[model samples]
Structures are given as structure tokens and as C-alpha cells.
Target: MRHLTVFDLDGTLVDTPRAIVETFTAAFGALGIAPPDASAIRATIGLPLGQAFGALLGLPADDELVASGVRRYQIHFKEIILPRAPELMFPGVTEGLDELRGLGITLAVATSKVHASADALLRSAGLRDLFALVVGADQVAHPKPHPESGRLILRTLGVPAESAVMVGDTVHDLHMARAAGMRSIAVTYGVHGPRELAEARPTWIADTFDDVVGLLRAAPKGLAG
Candidate 1:
């Protein structure tokens, strides 16, 4: 049986906090509004861009100001973040992905970024071709913690919920997996701590990217469940 492993982009496969933080700062600055502190911004890493800005600015996600901020953030991200893509990836990610592919596990991405931006970042990082599909917030009716993106990926890949696993670093990812009836692996090396991730009840918790590889290797049958 074939297995599918869907990953969250920002914190799972790539360490994008610096670029994200910088872009947020720049966006707020452009709007003449003070940006949230780096830690506060980092905590919102896996959320949709507008939602993150909404939380930071204390406005609704669809507020006009928040919309403007999101647009600015995207502009800054392209100018400042995409160029740093290759260096932003975490260690062991490339090797682990290659190993998983060798094991014949299909890979896909479900991220909070807009579809175009996510695709651009992956292509810049040289990881785009590794994934069979890349689903982003714009492509779905709802974003993370809603399960629409996860369900979309499974449907697009022709994989059953039980035969796929969602690997990510946030409660949003975990909750999405649960709502979609897929297993989850939460990595502690990202924005969330073990305690926070544990609340989401992930199937496995990984301290490093290599542990993710090991978990899958030890659970070939589990992947098919």
C-alpha cells in the first residue's frame, strides 16, 4: 500500500522565522504601525498571514488594515525572504525528504502561505520537485485548524485519511490532522514547545528532523492504516 506524508512548510521543513519576523516588521513599519515583538510574531508562525497580522495588530483577519498589512508582508517577503530561502532550511530536512521518497512515501505540503508564495519559496529552496502537491491557504475554503487544506491534499493525492500522516510543529497542524482523521507528528524544534504540542495529542513528537525519518521508518505499516 502507498502512504502519503503531508508537511507544514514554515516551521516543519524550513526555518523561516527570521524572514517572517523581518517582513512583519517591515510591513508594520510601512503602515506606520508598530510591529509586535519578535517573540509574539514567532508564536504566530503557522497561522495564515492575515490572521497572524490580525492577532498582532488586534484587528480582525479581514480588516482593511490587516489586509493592507498582509499585502505589505507579501511584498517584503518576496524582496527580503525569498532570496534567503536556501539558507533558511533546517538541517537534515533535505536528506530526510530524500530518504522518505526512496521509501516510496508520497510527499505534499499544506501551508498557511498563499499558494503562489509557498510554491515560490519551495522552488527557490530547490525542494519544489520533491513534493507531489503543494496546497496553500488561498486554495482552500478555510485555513489551518479547519482541516480543509488537509482534506484537500488527501483528495488531490487520492489517499485515504487513514493512510496519510500530517507532520508539523504547531497545534494548528495537529488539530487539522485530527479533524481530517489523519495521524500527526509534531516536531518540537519549531515554534511550539513540547508542552504546547502535547496539548494537541500528536501521534509522535520529534525533537529533530532525523527523528521524523526514524518514526516513519519504524512505522511503515502504521502509515498504511
Candidate 2:
């Protein structure tokens, strides 16, 4: 069993992709830039907000445009995204979480979202108390695809990366887990399909949150928790 379970927020636990996409559209319009394709915006779900928008919208990653994009999104996010949120938290998510908690597993959230947003979403969705620690972008020096986010979570939980499993719905999460030397588990129901996540080399892949619990239970010793 995995001793430490790290999760991604947006696409992994909550289906807030619509809110995210709409916020990006508003941001682009505010900046006088063309909005990205809907699918491309959706595909940005699990990446770091700035990096995701920069990559999808063709904005220079290191330029002020990226910062402006984030700022613009924040302007409308409270009114648009937050109001539209607290969406589907995925089938079996709470159940699996409860099961893991019962088994004495430590849970942490390693997400690129700001801490306030992540906390609000979790509290609104009745999952605020599920995690022992919430390592949001506000708390981490680096976002996903970088090990720092996961490392911070692991540090907070007092568990080594060897004892952790990172559960998310994107290649970014997979890459993050890999960078942290933690096991990676992908779910197909999130932003990226199985095909897209396949190239990330996850240790396990599931179609649903329920399947994820099963995989975790059966995962070989020393792999997770």
C-alpha cells in the first residue's frame, strides 16, 4: 500500500475544465489576443496555469504576456470560474479517499492552483478535510512537471518519494511524479485520454477513480505507500 498519496486538483479530482477554459477565453480577449481552440484549452487542464496558457495560446513562456494572461484570468476567475465551480469530483473519489484514510494512508494535494483556490474548491466540494496537507502553487517553488511540488508534499507528509504515489490525469502529473521519483498513476477520465498519457510512462493507468483504488491496493510492494 502507498503510505503517501498525492493528488492533482483540477482534472484529477474535479471536473473544472469548463471554468478553466472559459476563464482563458476571457483572459485572451482582455489581452487582445486570439483565444485558443477549445480542445487546446481543455488539454491544458493539468499543466501549470502560466505554462499551460503560454503553451496553448502561443504566448512566450517567460514574457510578460504569460503574467498578463494569468492576471487577466484572475480578474474573471472569481466571478466566472469560482461561481461555475465545485463541479463533479469524479465517481468513487470520496470513497477511495475514505478507504485510503481508513488504511492509515497520508493524503496530500500537489496542485498548480493557488492555495486559496484549491482550499476553497476542496472545502466547497466537501474534501477540505481529506488531505493532511495541500501544497498549492502558492506553497511550492515549482509547479508540476517539476519535482518541487511533489517534493513539498512529500516533505509535508514526512514521507519519502519512495513511499508516495502521485495520482493525476495528465502527462504533466506523470512527469512531475517521475521527476520526484515517485510512482505515477494516471486516470483516463481526466483531461488527457489513455493514449496521451501513455507516452508519460505511468506505473498504472485507470479508466475511473474506482479502478484507481483497485490498482493501488494491488500495486506491488515498495511501489506505493
Candidate 3:
């Protein structure tokens, strides 16, 4: 009977594979470094920019190279990628969200994207006003998998962890839910597969956005009708 739902933005709600791939590719070129394969970039979508850059480049998390890469990625993403091809909501996203809202469920966003960018993306996609809270990676001391973002969202929304669920597409999202002591629903159509999400042990797995809405509709007595 989860009353509060925290969602991961990039792959779960919005389709940003193309923007991510192109941004990182352009960023790597800006740094005069060889670009990682597109798959490599896709695999790191849910992580914070610095961590994603570190993972893609095989550098230490705090390395100067990682910082430089993150900066470059942000620049290209804002200046070129976002303007050229802003990410769009995935199929059924708006409808599912609308249905959930109608059911009196509170929605929030917990994403690894920086605050301004995350805000702008949601606004551009006509979703900024839908979420009750939008916790960004930069707003927290630690991002997903550490639970800072999730915990903050729950606290701000005044929702108990046990009465909330994190809906996401990546292991990071599931792990963050577990770490925050909340239930998790993993979607398979995002950045990661069921095998990867299973490693994080989500309470449920959804194949489509409508399936996620169904899960909410079936929630306990007070949560759903």
C-alpha cells in the first residue's frame, strides 16, 4: 500500500538514450579521449555524472579526468543535445502518471541528473508540475544506491519508507530503494535488464509503464482503490 512513489527519470520515464550517447561522445571528443562504445554509455545512465564518467573512462571517482569529463558532458548536453533532441516521455508515461495521480498517489522524482538540468528537462517535457518532489543528485550529499535522494524525498513528502515505493529501470534505483528501506519496482525497458535489476532485489518487475500503474492500482486498502 505505497502512497508515495519515487521514480527514476532518465530511462524509466523518459527515453534519453540518443541524447546520452551523443552527449558523452561529444564530451569525450572535447577531452581528446577515445569515446567508449554506446553500450558502455547506456550502461551507466542511472549513475551521477562524475561516477558515470569515471566508469566509462575507467578512472578513479575523484580523478581530475572524471571531473573534466563530467563538465564537458554537461556542456554538450545542455548546449547541443538538449536543444537538438530533448528526451521524450516513453510510451504510456504520461497516461500512467495521470492515472496514478487520479488515484491520489503522490509522485516524486529521484534522479542522478543535476538540479537545474533535471528541472529544465521535466519542464520541457511537461512533467515538472506533476511530481510533488524532485530530488536531484547535486542536491544530496550522496546519490542513488546511497539512499540520500530517496530518503530526502520520503522525508520531504512525509511518507514513511514502508509506505512508499521506488520505481526505476536500473540496479542503482533498486539498490537505493533497498538502502532507504522502501519497496522497489523495477522496469525492464530502461537501461538495465531483469537480471541486473534482480541483483538489487526489487519487490516487483514491470515490463511496461502500464504494468507499473497496475501494480499501484493493486496496492493495499488505503493506498489504492
lDDT of 1 by residue, 1-225 (tens): 779999999989999877889999999999999888999999889999888999998989999999999999999999998999999899999999999999999999999999999999999999999999999998988999999999999998999998899999999999999999999999998889999999999999999999999998777676655
lDDT of residue 86 for candidate 2:
52
Question: What are the models' TM-scores?
Answer: 0.97, 0.88, 0.92
Report the alpha-carbon TM-score of model 3 versus the true structure: 0.92
Using lDDT as the measure, what is the rank order of every candidate, best first? Answer: 1, 3, 2
lDDT of all predictions: 0.93, 0.82, 0.87
What does each candidate score in C-alpha RMSD?
1.0, 2.3, 2.3
Clashing residue pairs in candidate 1 are none
The model with the greater TM-score, 1 or 2, is: 1
Candidate 1 runs further than 4 Å off: none
lDDT of 2: 0.82
The candidate that achieves the highest TM-score relative to the unseen native structure: 1
- Which segments of model 2 are wrong by more than 4 Å? 220-225
Hey, what RMSD does candidate 2 come out at? 2.3
Tell me the deviation in Å of residue 22 in model 1: 1.1
Say which candidate scores most in lDDT: 1
lDDT of 2 by residue, 28-104 (tens): 99999889898988877776677877897677767788998888887887777665455567877888989888877
**Per-residue lDDT over 1-225 for candidate 3, one digit per residue giving the tens place of the 0 to 100 score:** 448989998988888866889899999999998899998998888889988998888889899999999888888877764553334678888889999999888999999999888887888788888899899999999998888999999888889988898999999999999999888899999889889888888989999999999997776453321
Per-prediction backbone clash count: 0, 3, 0
